[model samples]
Target: MSTPVEQAFRDHWGRVLAALIGFLGDFERAEEAAQEAFAIAAERWPRDGAPDHPAAWLLTTGRNRAINRIRRERALAAKLPLLEPPRPQADQPAIPDERLELIFTCCHPALAVEAQVALTLRTLGGLTTEQIARAFLVPEATMAQRLVRAKRKVKAAGIPFRVPEGETLRERLGGVLAVVYLIFNAGYSAPPAQGELAAEAIRLGRALAELLPAEAEAHGLLALMVLHDARHDARVREGELVLLADQDRSLWDAERLAEGRALLERALALGGRGPYVVQAAIAALHAQDPPDWPQLAALYGELARLTGSPVVELNRAIAVAEAEGPAAGLALADALPLERFHYLHATRGELLGRLGRDAEARDAYRRALALVHDDAERRLLERRLAALG
Candidate 1:
């Protein structure tokens, strides 16, 4: 249902913006110019037809817009030094994919981790402030302020707009990987055909793995995403959510699964035992004909110890329920400090239902329904609640 211009925007927004940033060396100005270019494209492309190379056209248009703006503000132009434009090369990509550099700049340790992830989503993932805000479950105004502060910090601290080298790369890599994974999670959680964020995240993961071929976590992250994404088609059916246990395995993408397994093998071969590697190993096990519940519970326990996150503990509880029993999982879940998290209640509901505690299960399901927002999830919870009667 999207116009050609809108489709082009979705495909090339990040690349065009990255090129503009590399040219103008200012995030605000680069964004302004990119918007201007897209605005122009929306108007003109509809009538005149899209250019042969949309990205190249957009980048050139944005660059010219920036130059024109500088010319108009003579005092500002005089006060600020600009890089000389690089000569055009025939062999160069239409719009150079400088997103890696942009992401590194956004994820610099100088900024807070939340800001780093938010800023990367904005600048390199082409996500709107509202989209990023919703992903983080924060108000739009709060997210706007956070983004403003992050950009200001980047400018004030003069974070270099280039990928780091040597020890610095190793130091910054964790933040970058985390940002990419969060982006993936946001996309993965969305309803089917809602956005290209998951594919975009996988693309970024591929870039990271290629950029750091020896970095086991990079490969692990890529493997993790691909493995999970392989089940995208089977995750939903007939406009309803599908649990992994009930999903049609025939719907899963074999190619992606194979690629994921190969990548996991590569990561393990490289001595990966980090959080991502552990998660990748878990995902691989999930793909098996019959999952190893005991081994899975053990791996989740290891992950819980490595991350010390309550959410990870919650996942471990579920695995324990499968490996041990519902009472065991309920015992662990009841002690967690995640009173406000709906998933905890949802998990309790499922485990309680399995144990034939109808009344308690209904209460937990209702509690989850109260907190849940997504239509697909809400419907699932409602069905489960009704089944108790």
Candidate 2:
């Protein structure tokens, strides 16, 4: 179990950092002050007990630290206008939650997509550079350089620390949503130690939906993530990965599943026919006792048309196999240019096994096993390969 201060840091890191950035108007400085405040909290809170309002306390502490650093550096000529006398704790003003603004700033259209994702995960998701690198399968130094270049771009381009307006908001919404979903995916498949990323992404999704109630895709994305997360406990058994069809329904989070369904309804009512909405619908279907494979295949088909993603097409093939037959699905999968994708080979292996083509199935499973990385997934593939004997 985490200490109270540790929990508070997780809960408030983004808010405090966002508040500091708004105050200091510099990402690096804001991040450094937030880290210093958390360091102070880690040292003092255990000895003195946690603050009554930890987020507020962290914000004030971080702001003071930043201000003091500015004064010490004598860069007052440049930052003097932004500085203010630190208020006593008794008279501290209520800090507005500026995480939404911070995320928009991080995800500015002026920045590259990868940079926007790295910056948002760093500032808003509060993930360390190493953690972000692990999630993206990149070297730590590479991720760090990306972050540095991103911050420099933000500074040089003078991207405003505010959400865009009107059509601009709509245009920018896609990138923001993509970043949030990428964070969720990172957490979803992350090692157990890093699973908190998924929860953090959901928290961000909830905030995005609440702050932009009119954005159907935001609600759709939240619904998709929540529905999948509802089955998190059932996705693995012991130390092995569990296929969705074999998962124990009793292990599912009933309340979260209901919430996902409600959110899906809300998105659909808002006339959301976007890719995220379609994917949420598929997740909702998967929660059923026996999923409607035909409906799922149709949804995947629609999603493929919308996104033009081969991954979606691969998923469609799986659904088609369930609804139609192995031959039909295998034909679709074979036509795709995804030979290097392990999941494709795995799916083909399953389809071939069902067709009694043991040799081809073995070859397919071997290909999948060669590309598989996750321990649980690798174990599952190994079991499948052995069963072919």
Candidate 3:
């Protein structure tokens, strides 16, 4: 349908605009130029047939439009340079390659964590302001203002518009990967049941992996997302959550599972050790063709040792449940500040359910239900409570 085509066009527009802005060193003018380029495409593509390299066409046309506009504006009125004394015509900033420089500038560490994530989504990730706002639970107006401020800061700070070399490349790449994983996590942890989790996460994950093929952890993270997402259908009942223990294994996406395994295999081959690699290793065990409970348990243990995070501990508890018993998982779950997160109690309830502690399980479910804001999560917890009743 035209909807998919329109969506694709918008996605390309954002990417090309961002790339061209990186090229021109003028964020404000980029969208106008990209739009003009698209207007040409819309007329030409339908009549003369689509071009061979449509994206490249868009980028080239947009840059040309930007240059023409700059020339026209300059001809209209002579303006003094704000940053420096009048420069010789020969002394001008060199335009860097678009895509690489764009990535580096957006990933700059000076921005707040939230701003960095938002900028990447707005630029390379090709997501709309509304989509980004909803994802972060911020008001659309607030997000718009935040983005405006971020762009202004980018211009004012005179952030270098080029990819770094060596040590600098390593540092910038860390922020880049962090943003990708942040987006992935946002999509992955969507209620752990339903409402467009896998599809949304996979969309961004695929983008990240494609954008940075040499970055092994990116592939590993995508594999991890794919592996977990493959279980979406099996993750819940009709509308209620079916714990990992009770999930129907037959319902898992076998094709996705295979893809995830293959991706992890590639990641392991690359041998880039990082948080993502470790997480992928944990996910890899869950996605084993046969689902090796003991191996999966061991992987979680290793992950906990590396991260030492309470969230990881909570996850490790789930893995321990498969290897040892519910009592062990419950004991592990109990040793932390689980009240801050509803999932912690939800998981504890599942382990308690397995331990034949129906009353305690019911209590855990009730507590979790109270903390949950989503309707589906509330319904799931109610169903669990009713089962206990």
Task: Kindly list the per-residue Cα lDDT of model 2 for residues 1-389, writing each as its tens digit.
Answer: 99988898778888889888887888999999999999999999989988888888888888888888888999989888876666666345477788888989998888988898889889987889998888787999999999999998888889988878998898788889988898888889877766877987898899899888988999999999999999999988887889998899999999999999999999999999997899999999999978999999999999999999999999999999999999999999999999888999999999999999999999999999999887889999999989899
- lDDT by residue (5-75, candidate 1, tens digit) is 88888778877898788888889989999999999999999899988788888888888888888878875
RMSD of each: 4.3, 3.0, 5.3
Candidate number with the higher lDDT (2 or 3): 2
Residue 194 deviation, candidate 3, in Å?
11
Which residue pairs collide in model 2, if any? none
What C-alpha lDDT do the candidate models reach, one value each? 0.87, 0.90, 0.73
lDDT by residue (1-389, candidate 3, tens digit) is 56422554655655676667865567667767877887888777777776555666677777777767766788424422311222232233232235556767777898887887788777765566887888788899999988888888888998777778888877777787677667667766565432333454465567656766777877887888888878878876775666665778899999988898888888788885667777877776765555676777677777777777788888888878777888887888999876779989899888888888889888888889889998877887887778777
Q: Could you tell me which 10 consecutive residues in candidate 2 have the lowest summed lDDT?
A: 84-93
Error of 3 at 307 (Å): 2.4
The candidate maximizing lDDT is: 2
> For residue 254, what is the lDDT in candidate 3?
91
Worst 10 residues of 1 by lDDT: 85-94
For candidate 3, list the clashing residue pairs, or say none.
none
What TM-score do all the candidates reach, one by one?
0.77, 0.86, 0.82
**Candidate 1: misplaced stretches above 4 Å?**
1-16, 32-72, 75-82, 88-97, 109-118, 127-150, 165-168, 192-194, 327-331, 352-375
How well does candidate 2 score on lDDT at residue 1?
Answer: 100
